[model samples]
Target: MTTTTPRLTGEYAIDPAHTRLGFVARHAMVTKVRGSFHEFEGTAHLDSEDPGNSRARVTIKAGSIDTGNQQRDQHLRTNDFLDVPNHPEITFESTRVRQVGTNEYHVTGDLTIKSTTRPVTIDFEYTGSAVDPYGNLRVGLEGSVAISRKDFGVNWNAALEGGGVLVSDRILLEFDISAIKQK
Candidate 1:
């Protein structure tokens, strides 16, 4: 017997209602804080015949960051952090996509945050593909990458009374994407 995988070749737009662009960071060297960007849009062009030909682009509104805390969310948009008024958008543009495993891909891209651009790679697992109730062909993927907050010029922290810093330098970016193929 032989089996074949379904071709996922098409231009897809990310469904914000089914996608999550979140981040996790350590706070006070004790616990972790998680947040998600509520306003973002992305698109992907997948070439099943040549995975390396795939491409992706995303733009996140810096002012839409939410942590479930009104005060903290406001603080995050200030000059001490995102500086939303100055750098209103965070963006990512894929430079290359390579398959490293049967269902895993390493996507290397340029991530721009607060006017600073850096190269970052995320390892994504192809979760699955399905047809939604709305009759849309959808594809799912999950990925995460750890990066230094300071690398993007987001270096505002206070010293703890006892030890360590108020905020961790390392941040973990997580993605749960559901993209619908465009006709």
Candidate 2:
């Protein structure tokens, strides 16, 4: 017989300092570039009795995109890419959550980028839960989802001399989230 672990029910605010909002994209069709956003905020409300009742939301500052190279980062914020001047934020709001397996969940949400909104489903694993030294309750979750850049209106690309595009259309969004349960 298998025993089920009870879910932790509460409202939690994502800890930006301990959380990583990162992404991976193929560069030049031969290499992968990893980058992360430095500024973002998110919250999650979990329902212990009904996981499907859980909800989450997040907002990221498009200008905070950093891939180590200053020139490349700046280019990402321009009209050819993110167009941070016009679309300053990328947001996500969960519409549904379902348990797919032990410690795993499928979260469906609306992701908005640039001027487009698309539905995305991210698979998340409940890594763990614990009490911090500061006497705070915390939960950890890890998840990722792949999205098409063109679907979000980010259509800029360069052709390589030998053929193929400079960047891949697929982008992987990763989350390593640590959230503190509110009292």
Candidate 3:
């Protein structure tokens, strides 16, 4: 099968204010908890001619986790969890991208969280591109991936009387990214 060529263009930086790195997890096996990383940075190489050749890298400050509750956030940063003191950042570096369909691709990369590096693949969609009102060209991408929290060193949990656990292992990561092309 012939792959469509994409036009390689300028560098782009993620607009932190407009880009949100969020996650959701099942809470108590009946509810969902949503949260986001308040401090992070990312860069993208957008290629209009070869979509598969495009790339992205992201760095997230471990201490920037916020779930709207101070106590919960503190727990997440403890040694039993993210261990922000030891592993201060979570990062991702793309290794390859393969187009699955129009505007869709499988992005495989090495994701490091809390000192553990694992291979993760995110199903990503290119949501089209346009020139913004500020005269900056922007590209959009959205993706989601599910990961096991334990695999990343987050292994703390509390046993419940109902034979369940207080924390769920599965974490759903969602990315809504908007990047401005550098002139």
Candidate 4:
């Protein structure tokens, strides 16, 4: 006889319009280049009483990268950076969630960029949960992670006469996501 597993309920899908997947990197050793993913999707599954059991996944379309400059965005999608033609998407899948405080967690996951999967940890915060005006159960989450661009094969650079590189290797990822519960 086949048995049915109990439906695991706290399912939610990311609200793409309201969610932001942003990144910041030092530019020209004097400024910062800030950009966001224009197309992405994510989901969250959590237990109301025990958020430690939560699971999450996010997928980002490489071509949707935008920094408010069309030329720069195109360059970023080329071989010098994301190489969108060869690597269509970047993805993250949580492997574990460790609660370190009342509302803080270290979310460890596998982040795949340009087909290379690496382990990453994000400092996460569960803001709260609420029922929106549309009657959808929603949850808010925020997190940040820092990673080296070179680690993901984006090694393009230019040396400046002043002795610094045109870009910094470290990139900071920031996320403010909201997900609507599944019926």
Per-model RMSD to reference? 2.2, 2.0, 2.3, 5.3
TM-score of each: 0.96, 0.96, 0.93, 0.93
Error of 2 at 125 (Å): 0.5
Tens digit of lDDT per residue, candidate 3, span 1-183? 013334226689999988889999877777888999989999988666666677889999989999898999999899988999999999999998888887788889999998899999999887867778888877778999999999988889888778878778999999999889888
TM-score pick, better of 1 and 4? 1
C-alpha lDDT of all candidate models, in order: 0.92, 0.92, 0.86, 0.86
Is 1 or 4 the stronger prediction by lDDT?
1
Clashing pairs in 1: none
Q: Comparing 1 and 3 by TM-score, which wins?
A: 1
Model 1 regions lying over 4 Å from their true place: 1-6
Model 2 C-alpha lDDT per residue in residues 1-183, reported as the tens digit of each score:
001335368899999999999999999999999999999999999876788888999999999999999999999999999999999999999999999888899999999999799999999998888889999988889999999999999999999999999989999999999999899
The total of clashing pairs for model 4 equals 0
**How well is each residue in 117-139 modelled by candidate 1, as lDDT tens digits?**
99999999888888899899898
Off by over 4 Å in 2: 1-7
What lDDT is reached at residue 44 by model 4?
75
Over the stretch 66-121, how does candidate 4's per-residue lDDT look in tens digits?
Answer: 89999989999999999999999999999888777766778899999898889999
Question: Distance (Å) between predicted and true CA of 27, model 2?
Answer: 0.7
Error of 2 at 73 (Å): 0.4
